[model samples]
Target chain A: MTADALPPRTVRSAPDRLLAVLAAFDHAHPALCLTDISRRAGLTLTTTHRLVGALTEWGALERDADGLYHVGLRLWEIAALAPRGLALRQVALPYLEDLYEATHENVQLAVRDGGEVVYVEWLSGRSAVGVHIRVGARWPLHATGVGLALLAHSGQPFQEAYCAGPLTAFTPYTIADPARLRRELAEVRRSGVAVSSRQITEDTLSVAAPVHGRDGGVTAAVSIVVPHATAQAAVLVPAVRLAARGISRALGWRPEAR
Target chain B: MTADALPPRTVRSAPDRLLAVLAAFDHAHPALCLTDISRRAGLTLTTTHRLVGALTEWGALERDADGLYHVGLRLWEIAALAPRGLALRQVALPYLEDLYEATHENVQLAVRDGGEVVYVEWLSGRSAVGVHIRVGARWPLHATGVGLALLAHSGQPFQEAYCAGPLTAFTPYTIADPARLRRELAEVRRSGVAVSSRQITEDTLSVAAPVHGRDGGVTAAVSIVVPHATAQAAVLVPAVRLAARGISRALGWRPEAR
Candidate 1:
């Protein structure tokens, strides 16, 4: 096919087209060439070239010696201002570190993003059991302990809407059924913790608790992952809860507010 | 003072206008209203509105309940791919944590950006001296231990340019004289460490070492900040150097390669 043979399609807005170029780079594809971006963004080569040039000039994208483009430090600096991401993580890191120190397990902090939980901070101990969680990773609200803690505390309408869904199960123990999920959530609310055993992985278990903000609303969740075979959920619950409460207080969540 | 009283300036490209909206937010001004964004971005209200709408839809800028816009999680997720930001911090954190444990002081990992050192990670100990450094904060090249380590190893052209003149001094101990800065850089290179004594603050001292990449080039620097009154630079040098070497090895740098 010749370049001039095809006719032009409807044009996308400048912002949409430019954002598409950035969206083309994700965890699985953190680096891409001009052609790859053009193809992935579904934009013509000329458009992609112009947009990439603009983004590169503005320091949103950096082109390496290999001619592959990666996200730039300038963008990272700006993204550090994200309240729900680095900003929140910065506030919660010390408590998370304490949790790791207390348990020597994989400690994580996450927040609800619609019906999913987005991990904002993850600290993995050297000998901790693998749970496949990383910062910026997301999972369904019913699949992980942090997810459950956040889901249980999310306001009634959002919780109900999420519970009504076709819950995707990762393991046999995942809370796929609506009634069972409701029961679990209620238990989490009552006990101030969520324990998910072999839900995401058969060999791993998680204990999580909700972190509240100044307004007395659950703003995030903190969790620790351990080996399911040797897991002591009861032992981990207090440490997890303590970390969550420490973070909550750090966020200005006073006991009287609750 | 009336509508349409001032004629419009020359038009900016759509991508530039959209980028301006994102650039409007920073550490000092992390949140903004539509009017604030419009004024700061130097775009007309209607243009800012449209660009912001596009960004909001694309999850670049999130509008909170108070009608203030903040950097969104989506941007943070994308920025996580930056090689010098979270990606590098993720690799260096365990070693940095070990340094914190060993010294019971503030441990930091920083990368040179232009002539400044941008801290990529900071683990603050409970009793650590307060040096006013945070993740994503930048400091002049001659004013910090990490900065000195990075600058000393940055090669001839950059070091010469940085040491030439106009070194901003944070304290009386800061290296402001060009000849003295050159001598310090030479000593840093020879000693494989940089001890910045109360350069940034009167009561804080930092000991730092350069971290090398697989290709034998210095990529970052790791440091420990302690109270000058109790700081034993001789005791700290080995710990900081060990942490930096640990991170360098983790990053695939080998002594044989160097």
Candidate 2:
């Protein structure tokens, strides 16, 4: 389904209705008029109007002069406090910057969200290879370097379930076989790095390493994406690992504790 | 009032109660237990539980293994679409990075929110001056360089009202007098830059320039904060202004259109 596709309209409770109004918005539909919201949220126009008014007053949404509703600054302020979102990105930024400076390539920090990897931070130079990833973008857990590192370090049951099947391929090189995927994950665990070549895009490659949290759990993964033809996994691995370790240390990860 | 202070409880509507539960979390109280949220939101334990359950189910809030609630990744994804928040920061980040590279100081992008300036992005080197500013941090519009730039370019009515108010001074150098504040704003407009010295902190200074949107209105401001003892406004002004202009251009601002 498309990113903007709404789930079957089963919303019933007052809170659910209100949240459905919010759920109407996505990356593809950031701004919407009252009528559009009503349709997308599967709500009556009257209910949509009332809920929209409440949200606008509470600053969860903002209505522009043109009568389109957009997500507001207040919501952004609150979201910045998310431990796995901006907070993690803020802690990892300096290391990400150092990696960017060293590689002049596209750098990313991501965490696993169930079956997908959600990018929390991304930094790229003006001249870096074109990358489709952006903050908040998501990819399946087997199609990118950060995804592989996260999957390899994830709980066994989850890793097994993920390796079961339904792997979507973005390029010919994307690992579609369950056994091969499991083997690749094992390799990632052994080497402490994941090198994904021409997986998401044929011309792009990435090297990634996992970042640990204060409790020594793999909390996130950091990666650098470079052009496939000129990519040097050997050189990129150590830098990416160092950046990830720096972020892990900043997050209070102690290697000695393990 | 402190950042964590709650307003007198008058919230009655269903939407208001739900939003109140969200407002309970802030920079100072990012993680809260159910009891804490109940008190902060001025809701009964029963109501707080119901609202928290709804919010958690909707992914607006996440309850950790320890049962502490935090703003969730899904909410962050939705807030990423805020035109004045992450969206604006995304467009301006490359320019901010360039400014950081050139100055090796604390670089910031902020937008005016009522009488305050909300920092949307901040970048600093490991060795950059110790700055208290962080992403999502807010300050009075007359105190810091980005704030001053934003306030100077704000609408006349808003500017006049803000200038007439009780300006809280952080340091002796902060612009507290209405007349002097007005004069400083005038100079910011006349010089196309704002220089705020030892306003927020005694050891820091900043130079800032207003960033224009497509409509030729100042939508945000960019600034670089450095140690006050070595700050040279003459040297920093051009770089800050150029970064602001670069961001403005990226936002589709056209100088010829004006």
Candidate 3:
């Protein structure tokens, strides 16, 4: 159900209130005070206090010495089991490291979350080119190599919906037109790799390939970012593709299965 | 409150029941079906169905095609904000990568949770020595080198309580005696490093050092594992300590602040 479908604040259910307490936290607002939490969760002060107390006692949230609430280690421990999150990252890290070693650039792993790409892992050398994305950073499907790789393999319905319009452009090179986006996806599928040049930033270029799972479906994408002035897509394409294949193999993908 | 102080299951609160549904999933039981969740959560079938429905709707748990529930990306996104978890690891990754480059061994970053050390990050080279610990693996405070480093700097009350005995042993080299444990901790404090030789496994040895935060508190530990037979603790000690210091500095630790 959409956010609009939720009952009024006064008539919200117990589970909704409890979930809302967790929903109050996000990438931009990691830590919050009691009043901040109450206001964000849309709950009364007393109810927010009681719910926060229960969550803290259950080790879902931690209260620091400064009396601010942050996500706790126990929740991280539980979240570590997410198959598409850390579990997938663990299997892909070695391959990502190899890609970093080969290119000495910024290597990344990302998965599609709706119309956006969420980075799960990133490896960069000390002297690597500057890339502004962090581990949990998100970008639109048309503006990143990893995003393009994931969107390319996401099937017709999702690709159609995402390319329908409103494709946010990050730079002059970003693909904003629906027909051009469809052509790019077809090229990505045909060439087994995607090269997004100066799409997210004026000086950055990315080359990416899709990673398959045991079920022979594309589950994630691997990419390497370098300076646009020093871009060598042809040389980097094989390395990125090899790393993606290695990670897919580690995840139990078989060439014969394809 | 302790487990014994909680009210009977029959009269449990709604929040507690909902949390119980989540608590049912752990490392050993990462995926479960509806029936399994019902039994493991100690809730009636109807309650289990309702709670699971709510959780799945909120994207806290994902139901796979096989009808098994696994932790979802949304929960992982929230958990990524844990200060002692991914947040700490992100700040420390470049230093950890430098350590890996210098030694080409298995490198790890961990933090203490009560009397145990929980690994937050690990980097291993292709030819690195075999270490069985994963990202979320836990070990007793007196067993591994990171554990020892954390336990030594965990303050006097915690040290005393932990050294009071019943320390479990993994191999013959594990610290099991209180008096010897106390001596080792003292040496760790004096040397600014900890050496755990064949403590967790007969073939592996670890060298670790404490990472201090801005408040001059030991917030985490960095370690390297190598083959026990060829381990040169002296060479590894400086590298591990330097990495720990670099991570501490990145975390805003200043030498003059001490």
Candidate 4:
């Protein structure tokens, strides 16, 4: 499967073709012309046109007045009912807000999606430490505090396999060694807290804890991003853990009550 | 469309079938078994199985340990990026909160979908107003304050056509008459506010104002609900307008600058 022997455009099934049109859109390219979509999705002009038209008609996609396409409101409406997405954020936001108010930091709520952490909610006050992540932004499983907490509870085999991955480093403090990453994950599980210090950026640190669902399994994670220079990392750990526990209780997770 | 004959089920295309499978889980039926999906989507068991499998694999639907299917995190992640949905809500929430803090009432944000007003965001406060609408719930365009505010600004032809509808009445205050509803819409447009007094319930009043997008077009509406007995509807009008203007300005809508 060398680059020289690759097919011009691989044939895709109907469902795959339809999904490819959606995949053509991301945070980088939220709006795309038909030509851009066809080029990015690696489909012919005719196929792209038909698929886009079908999606637009079904309200899965929207065509603006300028002839640009974006995801439509109907799809957003349907997606609002996703339990793991807005529903979870809906329950966790109050606690997240309390944490933000208490600490004046960047508060985040994220869930595991495949091997990445997709932020479901993020709130930052005016004077909070800056991080460029948005609600729909994704990050690797080992770089973010929320990511570390989610990855720690993701089961044993997943941890082993992910630790073997090709880790990318933005700063020297980023975990690139498999052995160190494995040890960090173990510490995260043992302490019930994940401290990702100066991982994503040199000037920032994050304290995170897991959020459990009705079944007492870690369904999501909450974290607070603070400036490394002024952060009381140990003190922030209890605050993050409390918020996570409050959210988990709100989501129907109860050990003592049961 | 008739009550005598059943609709054609098998004639639906592959795209339609896939869309139907996603649509089968709504606010009422947020989780469904494989059998429930087949029956609700009006598809055969085999077709439902295959489409659900593909959607599950693609992260559009998630099957729980109990084998029940719920809307998945991926769809929610994509929806969070929608400008008219959570993206809009996130920007408007602070203002919505300000309005709520000014008066501890039920705050809501709604957008026009077809002829109905769909509630996109809601904050339940301690004050009791009786009409309990969830985030994704829809109501008639003429029966709610936010709905009237949005419907009044939609366009001349749309307002005219909507006023000719078979309006359903929840109470005597509800605008079931076409002529009176048209008059009320005119008042809403003239005043830049909509005050619906017990339109949907016997003891509730909602004051709403229209929200504008960057292009200065009316895109959505925001409202605050309070008890009809204790509410000074006149006093709330200014606060509602101020909050709406704040949200509009935050969205880059500049009336004077334009």
Task: Identify the leading candidate in terms of DockQ.
Answer: 2
Off by over 4 Å in 1: A1-9, B1-11
Clashing pairs in 3: none
**Candidate 1 DockQ vs. native:** 0.74
- lDDT measured at residue A166 in model 1 versus the true structure, 0 to 100: 91
Docking class of 1: medium
Candidates, ranked, DockQ: 2, 1, 3, 4
Q: In model 2, which runs have C-alpha deviations exceeding 4 angstroms? A: A1-11, B1-11
The list of candidate 4 runs beyond 4 A from truth reads A1-10, A101-104, A125-127, B1-8, B100-104, B125-131
- Go through the candidates in order and give each one's C-alpha lDDT: 0.88, 0.92, 0.90, 0.85
Give the local distance difference test score of model 4.
0.85
Model 3 residue A59 CA deviation in Å? 1.2
The number of residue pairs in model 1 that clash at the backbone is: 0
Evaluating just chain A, the predictions reach TM-scores of: 0.95, 0.95, 0.93, 0.92
Per-prediction DockQ scores? 0.74, 0.82, 0.70, 0.51
- TM-score for each predicted model, relative to the true structure: 0.95, 0.97, 0.95, 0.90
lDDT tens per residue, model 3, A17-121: 999988888788899999878888878889989999999999889999999999989889888988989999998988888788777799999999899999989
TM-score, B chain alone, candidates in order: 0.94, 0.95, 0.94, 0.93
Tens-place lDDT per residue, model 4, B1-258, is 333222448687677778888888888889999988887887888988888888888888999888999998877777666667777887887787667667767889999988999888886643336566878789998999999999999988988888998899999889999999999988999999999988899899999999999899999999999889999989999999999999999899999978
Worst 10 residues of 4 chain B by lDDT: B1-10
Q: lDDT: which candidate is best?
A: 2
